[model samples]
Target: MARKHLVTHPSTAMMIRDTKAAEVAVLEHHERLDGSGYPRGLASADITPMGPILLLAEAFAYWDQLKVTLSPGTAKALADSAFAFADSCLLALQKALIDASPHTTPAPG
Candidate 1:
């Protein structure tokens, strides 16, 4: 079966083959900075870089939802709080992307 097709049905895939990546992602999902994470209970340093990025993305999405009922500033504030928990490297990369983004307004003439 194709990867995309299998992904559409998680249970079927689980019954059919090993779910190593899924298991690892789940382990990483509940991971924390205080060594309270699940599966292996990996801490901040123990978790890989990808874990924090996932956590940040989840926070940002939830923040966007909060924006629906709150002010834009409030939403941005929530997003910033989410960013605060991320690795500095991720924040720097995000800043670089924002600085270099084509959607950024050009300098005034």
Candidate 2:
């Protein structure tokens, strides 16, 4: 988690113009409800709203790259885990994938 703190140091935070939004986004991206994530080891309510969204997006992309396919099932599996992701973000991702699929009819949101 040292890396996390490094990003917010006076020298580093200045690089981001000391914007609270940017700082929080960077911190929350690695935070998890299970307290297994890095930097602050924050859990549940401590995490910002954008945190889960960024985590989900990164996880989905990484999983797709590693597996050589973007599997909606994998997205659902990750979202359904105990990571404490926002339900709305998961639902949005699901709807997006469904809408993009040629065979599956996009469910109403």
Candidate 3:
């Protein structure tokens, strides 16, 4: 899928003091934990922390906008589905981070 909106990354980064992080977040926000998302197909480990947050916010805004055109029940269902997908991706990303963390040895009592 050609995501034309991805071009906003550089423009957004140029306006922010934290250019790199902002750029990465914008670029990675569409990525999924299962590598099923667009532009890069990056997995959980590859995505930045802000990526998931942006994805969730975008999903909410999208569904919220659709509420105007869709029936209440349909809108609610779509919102729930979007939230579920975001939750699943977040959980997978959390798990990936946990798995990648270095184990620390406790001090002897």
Better of 1 and 3 by TM-score: 3
TM-score per candidate, chains pooled: 0.44, 0.58, 0.57
Instruction: In angstroms, give how far residue 87 of model 2 lies from its true place.
Output: 2.5
Error of 3 at 45 (Å): 1.5
| Order of quality (lDDT) | 2, 3, 1
Compose the digit string of candidate 1's lDDT tens values, residues 1-109. 3224333444543554457645444346546656655446676677876565656566555544444233345445634652334546445444544444444467999
For model 2, residues 1-109, the per-residue Cα lDDT tens digits are 5464546543454577646865676667877778777778888778877677767777667644454343567556766776656667767666655554444466999
lDDT of each: 0.51, 0.65, 0.63
Off by over 4 Å in 3: 68-109
| 89 Cα displacement, candidate 1 (Å) | 6.7
- Give the winner by lDDT: 2
Off by over 4 Å in 1: 1-23, 68-84, 87-109
